[model samples]
Target: MTRCRLCGSEAMASVVDLGATPPCESFLAADRLDQPEPAYPLHLRVCTDCWLAQIPPLITPEETFKEYAYFSSFSTSWVEHARTFVADAVERAELGADAFVVEVASNDGYLLKHVVDRDIRCLGIEPSVNVGAAARDAGVPTLTEFLSPETGAAVRAEHGPANLVVANNVYAHIPDVIGFTQGLRALVADDGWVSIEVQHLLTLIEENQYDTIYHEHFQYYTVASAIRALASGGLTLVDVELLPTHGGSIRLWARPAETAGEPSQAVTDVLAREKAAGLQELSGYTEFSARVAKVRRDLLRFLIEAADRGETVVGYGAPGKGNTLLNHCGIRPDLLAYTVDRNPYKHGRYTPGTRIPILAPEQIAADKPDYVLVLPWNLRAELVEQLAFVHEWGGRLVFPIPELSVVEAASSKEVTA
Candidate 1:
């Protein structure tokens, strides 16, 4: 029985056992297939004491993130999401040209670029050299280092305190939750607030999003655990707003605990919703493994049946969620001919473990396979618009997670769900 990362308690139990899998971002060149690929347990367990869900320590941050392939600018909607966030935050915080902003794990400067365009002072801390170089080229100042308490103090000493600190999808990636939160406290101005976006645990279980459980994501948090994490770092939660990004996420507003007071009704409402949904109990997590098993079985059967019928099939995106889904079901190139991606970094590379060939998006237009399995089904809205020409040849788009459904030509409105 491994102890929980947050509270160090020995009371933990399995939520879902996803078996051994490779790091989701570990795409391989053609020559590397002959070499043995490393994989680790993808099981998720929850601390009965804290209700935090996380995978055991099988890999280090350097092993998973350095030389990373995921760049944020690939998605059209996500960039606009950042633009909207910047506009709202700038107005809310009353930031001026002299005020400073900092972003932790800011990939490729996708969000910080918007801040710079407004003539606001901003800096990004990204660990990946390749992505950091891209950010610098785009004219956003970036520091190439993993965020720690020491690094945060150094940044404050040189650049002064930040008016706003932005962290998106970063908390779950690191093992040291307390240290990372402390780093946020060290960087932000005493009166300034931190805005964070993380996938809500309620959404993960309710939607059966098992594909998000790759090795890179060490922890899953509910509103309850989030409050605990922030409080440990001398921060206080002020508000919580649920977002539709990354399938489902929550944007948390926080400030220094000593200067902070009562959390808003939105925060109370979310906590009540989570408790009413039974997320505070061990039984809420125990039932998820069965749901994950059903998805694995149903998706495999659909692909096998389609292949047996002689209908050609391919994939739409090579997202981390797609990598987990493909590997968990043991689907190979035969079941899914090849997957296409817009990012040049992933082109000509094979997905880790499954070895499914990846091609550019143009391949879909030339081949026009009978079925184009949308791998990153969460972005089905944008993809459906971009790939509408597929419907001309009677090609149908399909989503395997949550449930297996062959989407109709006119029913793309489910994206709001």
Candidate 2:
């Protein structure tokens, strides 16, 4: 990426080069194991001009989301989070039964179902054919098309401008940040609200959540850069909220530039926090590569030491972030044994580059592995409780990010470093 995807600047600073890995979601069926798998350079860079951290757009969104593997409804906490967000948004936006709501990248109707329950008019724009079908089956009106300016305008023209456009966890997924933001503006009413939830660059760096860097996520954002990105599409940031989802995320409330008025104190506070952290300058990123290396070293050390001790370590969730960590750490089935996921679509498949076999969640209890590596470590609270049954077999749970830690499942207590 010689030029910044958002700013068009030639000065791109290196953040960290994770070597190369396949598209994180490219799970393989048993039949394709003999075929060659492709990998791409997984380097992250920040544009000096805009301070937006991004990766090279090696793989297109169509390649990854056309038949997406992720199902949002799989996580109970996330589902409830969506339900709560819907309730809050309706109340905050003063939405009524006559109000119209739209969700971009609405996965399996996990969120819009709440909108439907309220008897409000709603639509979902999902790219994946399979998941789009699932949303339709769940009675959520959906368009199986990628969100572009044209698609957004067409939806707005047909259904009339939406009262609210909810884009959760998808702001970083698109390579064309400006165009995607324009699509957002095209879908929303001039005075309607746009709520976006994306992983905060500040949290990703501070918490050592380097595993979230993948080809699919073309860019990362701090509130400062996010304000610039929002303006590029005629939307203005009005408020910001800190969220705990995906390790740490920021929920941005925006509106058409004309109606945006002044940003809330929350926005000013977050911007001050980012500036104080030195993210606006290069100082904040100087030590990040070294810290990321420490994370890689720590995780590899734990996995290798456990293998040498004759302890079996399987994985808890086959999430995309897990693939990045596994591939970056050079972990194969030899080190991880296998991983389990609740999503049935992945049960018989293999993780993209690591080639770690993905099994059903029941297999973890069946095999009684000595240690279970919780790859989706961001869900620490929920997974720790769910896997507490491991205590029955005297097993423990392991978390790799934000430093490697071992927990006794019996009491759900941190036991080791």
- Candidate closest to the true structure, highest TM-score: 2
Q: Which residue pairs show backbone clashes in model 2?
A: none
Clashing pairs in 1: none
The per-residue C-alpha lDDT of model 2 at residue 305 equals 93
Candidate 2's residue-wise lDDT over 326-351, tens digit each?
Answer: 99999998899999999999999999
- Which lDDT tens digits does candidate 1 get at residues 156-193? 99999999999998988988899999999999999998
Off by over 4 Å in 1: 409-417
Residue 384 lDDT, candidate 1, scale 0-100 = 80
In candidate 2, what residue range of length 10 has the lowest lDDT sum? 408-417
**Candidate 2, overall lDDT?**
0.94
Off by over 4 Å in 2: none
**How many backbone clashes are present in model 1?**
0
**Model 2, residue 321: what's the lDDT?**
97
